[model samples]
Target: MKTLLSTNLIYSIMAKEAFVKEAADDILRLTEWIREVFEDGGKLLIFGNGGSAADAQHLAAEFVNRFLINRRPLPALALTTDTSILTSIANDFSYDLVFVKQIQALGKPEDLALGISTSGNSVNVVKAMETARAIGMKTVAFTGGTTRPGGDLAAVCDLVLNVPSDSTPHIQETHLWLEHVICEIVEKQMFGTT
Candidate 1:
């Protein structure tokens, strides 16, 4: 049991360390994208499945409410927050249309869509990214595994951040760290504070 715990801890630690090393440039680009959108009064539309969905809502709340510092609320919406819309879209159209339809209706050219998928291939997220692109909205994705430079989710997203690990927990953990980093940078840039 100790060996298993130690192995898991080491795996997570090494995965995060490698991600931090490899992701500096990509992180900069993503922060810039968020900065541009917020500067332009564009909202962020975020979504994902399961834990990623929860992460989407968490990130949105950070933008809409507060992150580390106190400031005016930023505009951010998580498509996964509305169960009625999700169920309606799934029932009336299809499960894949949940986020796509929302993006089609709520998205604008200046807005941004962010999708989080551990496998980098969630169909609904891929569809949402595609729709957001066709609408001229910028798309960004947080996905798992470093092996896929750009997976199916990459075809539409303007930026893709893939955590360099196969373990879902490790991927999600790294994603949480990135989300905090992104919110902090965006808040600081938008509000002009530390």
Candidate 2:
């Protein structure tokens, strides 16, 4: 048991380290873009499915509340948090339109949409990204290596942060780390705090 646990931990760490080298540029670009969005009074709309849904909410909360620096709340909404809206959209239209409907209702051209799917192929997430693009909003995707790198989600997104590993657990772990880093940087940059 101990050996298995240690192996998992080592694998996770090594996977993240490998991804970091390739993703540094994209991470910096994402951070700058987020800062610009906030500076322009634009909100962030984040959505996903399953574990990715939880991640979406987590990232949004960090942005809207605070990550490191204590300052004014930033504008961020997790489309995954409102069950009523999600259920309504899923029931009335299609499960695939859950995030898309929310985007149509709340997204502005200045806003940004982030879709997280470890598989890089959640239908709703992809649809949301496409919708965001159609509306002239920038879209970003967080995904893992799959049969196709980033799958359909990457095709529609303006920027794709594709984690190098195909393992969902490792992908999610790295994603969470990146999310936290983004929050810290964005907070510091916007609030002029360390």
By lDDT, the best candidate is 2
- For residues 1-194, could you state the per-residue lDDT of candidate 2 as single tens digits? 99999999998998789888888999989999999999999999999999999999999889888888778888999999889998988888899999999999999999999999998989999999999999999999999984687889878999999888988899999999999999988887888875
The clash count of every prediction, one per candidate, is 0, 0
Candidate 2 segments whose C-alpha is farther than 4 A from its true place: none
Pairs that clash in candidate 2 = none
How far is 65's C-alpha from truth in model 2 (Å)? 0.9
All candidates' lDDT scores? Answer: 0.90, 0.91
**Model 2, residue 160: C-alpha shift (Å):** 0.4
Alpha carbon deviation, residue 15, candidate 1 (Å): 1.3
TM-score of 2: 0.97
lDDT of 2: 0.91
